[model samples]
Target: MTRAILEPVDADIDPRVLRDIYGQFPSGVAAVCALVDGSPVGMAVSSFTSVSVQPPLVSVCIANTSTTWPVLRAGRRLGVSVLGEAHEEACRRLAARTDDRFRGLDLHVSGNGAVLVDGAPAWLDCSVEAEYPAGDHTVVLLRIAGFRIDPRARPLIFHRSGFRQLVER
Candidate 1:
């Protein structure tokens, strides 16, 4: 059978269409947090990935329009929490544009000021390594100084513009 030709994407591509296409690929949600002025400031990011093993580096993409990122990045250290299945509400709160994002949540603050969600599957204490400007977003590289994991916990997944739970067969 012959394959049909597909249209080439252009710079003027619709953002909604791009978002819908991106949402089709499932990804783990992460809470990137740090203590700012003795308060926990954080945001949820689905565009998080491990970049390097030798240097223990990870990456998270933040929208250029994000107001929280500027303040969060100023902190000496940041906590990257791989949100678990039970963290749907937490993720929502973190992503919301509210004054108190960490309200009604269990948290742990490292000595270096990395604020991590207590029940998350994994936590990485990291510092900003580098930042690169991309189209409408900034790709941030983080250097992991320390990390922890819970073997039994399941990660929260983001797909099709919604939260999803893992179903093991």
Candidate 2:
């Protein structure tokens, strides 16, 4: 049986320590994109996850203070791009808070105008389903409308404190 990971008590723990401990688990990198008022907005996230298979659902969380998030969550379809090793630059661009995320990026619009990252390992065309506040962030759930997997590309992975290419086991 699984036990509680953290107790509801006054305990001291450094956030950086927590992040380092948690980051030990390797995770795939993803970028969530949406267009607000005709301007493309995006954010790089290592927290993307598949929530449900029956409903074709996926979720990504964004910090409440994120300037790019509100623009992306404003009621429009968004693209979920699972990055490949070749996408390191794209990830950096999207992750930067003050830089042009799309500069030097080769992307295009899909049916609902999501800024799809070209040639990603996988791309999901989805519409926002719901959002809920979670502590310092909001988790946005999406209903996957469609997806395309690039059979030729290797998926990107994040571990410790950096990116890595996923190799065959």
TM-scores for every predicted model: 0.97, 0.90
Model 2 residue 37 lDDT score: 78
CA lDDT scores, all candidates in order: 0.96, 0.86
Which residues of candidate 2, in runs, are more than 4 Å off?
1-11
Q: State the lDDT of candidate 1 residue by residue for 15-90, as single tens digits.
A: 9999999999999999999998988889999999999999899999999999999999988899999999999999
The positional error of residue 98 in candidate 1, measured at the CA in angstroms, is 0.6
- CA deviation > 4 Å runs, candidate 1: none
Q: List the residue pairs that clash in candidate 2.
A: none
Using TM-score as the measure, which candidate wins?
A: 1
Task: Give the per-residue Cα lDDT of candidate 1 at 4.
Answer: 100
Q: Provide backbone clash counts, one per model.
A: 0, 0
Steric clash count of candidate 2: 0
